[model samples]
Target: MDTTLEELYTQYPDTVKKNRKKHIVIKSEADVACPQIEANTRTIPGIISQRGCAYAGCKGVVVAPIKDMITITHGPVGCGYYSWGTRRNKARADSTTPKDKIYSQLCFTTDMQEPDIVFGGDKKLARMIDEIVAAFHPRGINICSTCPIGLIGDDIGAVAKAATERHGIQVLAYACEGYKGVSQSAGHHIANNTIMQNVIGKGNERKPGKHVINVLGEYNIGGDGWEQERILKDCGYTVNCVMTGDASYEDIKNLHLADLNLVQCHRSINYIAEMMETKYGTPWLKVNFVGVEATNESLRQMAKCFSDPELEKQTEEVIARETARIEPALEQFRKICRGKKAFAFVGGSRSHHYQHLLKDLGMEVVVAGYEFAHRDDYEGRQVIPTIKSDADSKNIPELHLKADEKLYREGNEYLNLSKEQFEALKKEVPLNYYEGMYPDMKNGDIMIDDCNHYELEELIKKLRPDLIFTGVRDKYIAEKMGIPAKQMHSYDYAGPYAGYNGAINFANDVAHTLTTPAWKMIVPPWERIEEPDTGKQEGAN
Candidate 1:
């Protein structure tokens, strides 16, 4: 049987023909080599990649979780503005906590500006920290540097160190430049490493419950982390501290107390997991609460870690109940989404995870590409048995470049293209007019799969896709054009869209976007406005 790529080539010849595999032709060859999928391609030229920079990953995902830690953007105002309350994690605002209530649910940021970025931001960051300390008296302050800071070479670490000594508060400086790598995946790693070095054991560390585990990777989007929190508690384990979701400064410092670290996001938190193992002698395990399969496996794994039969049995019961409740809904989604075609081009981790979930929904991924992925991420895809030629390399970007081939050819970067392979791809994965790079007529349909603002407008006019699955940015455009658009990134505001249960959530999100009432009301500018009366009003006439 032919491999998926081989089948695509055979099914559509010119649009899908094969290209000779790329071998690393050295610069001495003076030849323009075809574009091999480079992990560095995460920062697309002129195109805004959905991937966040290092500062964002650290500040948004890692540092922000510490409810008691004041985070300062230390750059342009747009950075803080864009990130403010953007995460799906839910917390009861301090206002909602009854007057007598003791807990505070607040997320804060030191919004920075142009002057801050242009001049060194150290003074501003220091002042911001001081302001936060004076107002909230936060237990700690985390200063996250943005792109400009890195470019200007502002020493955020030095500032943080000096401030920590003066204020007698924990101050962490994370230098996550946007240009550092392709996606937030890299940012996650950087953040994890910093935490291991700075935040892990800076304060009073009291040993907690023996069964306690440090939850990692889960971002608590849509309160997903809280839901998991409840489930774990029900299972009788003390969730010592969640990595950052609904997490606090005190909680994070005490993370060392937990006997084990339970990580949900393998790509992002695995580094920390490994570090915990080495430093504290605490073992770590990967757990996903996204789907029934992963969720069950995760619970069982946790139980095994404890070697407790009763806890395992209780976990089984919880799974059975949740599975039964969602079974009917999931079956319905399977029926609807079966055989639907999808092309995934999100950042790597989600791209990889989405493959399994989509396959479960009976949908086929016509094309899949990761904006930033390394050699390891491609192992399952690269080794597919049925692949016949190098053209099949598109299935796995790294495979396109033979071992000897250098990735960057001499002249211009954008000029890099594989004529034969691109032609075949044009056919094999015929994008719906809306999805492909250009508007030129092609033999097959196209889905403008991975896109940003500019592509959204152009493609809407040229391709006129039936449905556009994208992030929040393009939702309005697709709607204005009278086409269905689904925000797949954050599960369209509903998710845990990971396993079998996620299938139902995915379908519902798609359907909701497709069938929503707002689409019908959109009208063209010319049609909606009546011409202004030039002839004039009653009295003047």
Candidate 2:
């Protein structure tokens, strides 16, 4: 009987703010933790939670980046098929690259059949690696586990070890079972850890770009990495490597050569960044490349760290030129998008970070949710009263026998579940997902976290948000639905959407989505005419 706020209303309310009072309020002194959701929650015997396991994160985001690596989704074909290049990370294979080398850019999967899952996926994985080697001759392969793999106890690490020895190349295994954490965030950390262990420094290669820096956490989505690279080059610094986005195996092998690391997405890349700093004697800095404030500050801060007066001056110069380039268009977008309301549900740092950028365009984020976030990410944000997991809700539940029909009455404890059940839950859950359950949303606008296609489509159909800012997956759907969906993930093909120049890019991206002619191009299935029967007369003609 768990219900969404929209289900409670007779009709979907115009705004979350309008129907805020109808929802249940958390009682003070409640235990405030729901064992069902506590990463460790043992299936509650019956409550539903929308958290993905660790494997999904590793296979989906981290390991999927290996353009030259053959990845086997070692459980089910569905996971592999759905996750194949789901993001906007463009591959070099599709470009003017040679056909013989196409395997590097193509998404290869074991496409595990049911039989493999029933018995185990070890043999199939090894066979898939063999096939991949014959077809692409890649230097390495990765076997990523899925839900069933975890359940069946597949020792993918051992499998990878055997395969690597047999092939005389690198082979890594990731144990990212989706249920491993509360959200995909845990997967990111685990992914970073695996990279640190196996990929950081092993090969007989070193291109020490003395003036270069490693750009961490900035996935080359929509060429965002390329844009950042241009800016750095303009500032007279070579970008030696990008973390996973557009980063090559060789580039990563030589990553130690960089003088410093500039980390953008702190939540996902912090582990690797810190590891580099500790092991290599390379300093790392937390930087944001989102809005004018963060971008400018990040540049100035990095320049200060470099202790190079000329570099500091170059940073200022780059900012000035880029800022001037987009000022007029930004002003125009401000006029249309200003004062508009927004709500977000994104992975890791993006959910909170984008709020400031949206605000730059004069938009207000009435609601926000994160799929995988740490406590520090939410420390300063206000927590609103709403339905939350036992860990965060702090509410207690009591069974009230009201006229023979026993109903659970609200109590001070946050979790309604019994202790025995929570104790049986898993080892880790992404902390961010649990935190999302408690935000005082005020029901002002629609909010979602780790939303799937169906939920997003439904929300868009009902809410009709003014300018939908989300990743590329949701972008096309929004456009097809006649809703303005901006690619916040890649700045919608116009980037650097961070920094002083980025503010304009943000505005421009939003404006392009909002007023673009493409929104008008959505044609109904019934709109077009059928083909004429001209084929029958081909011989006679």
Q: TM-scores for all candidates?
A: 0.67, 0.69
Expressed as tens digits, the lDDT of each residue in 21-61 for candidate 1 is 12011121232321232232323355554556666666776
Q: Stretches of candidate 2 above 4 Å error?
A: 1-51, 93-104, 203-210, 380-465, 471-506, 512-541
lDDT for position 510 in model 1? 57
lDDT of 2 by residue, 220-315 (tens): 766666677767778877777776776666567766666667877766676676566456545565666776655676677666555567888899
Best by lDDT: 2
Off by over 4 Å in 1: 1-37, 41-44, 92-119, 203-210, 356-361, 380-469, 474-483, 495-507, 514-541
- Candidate 1: clashing residue pairs, number: 17
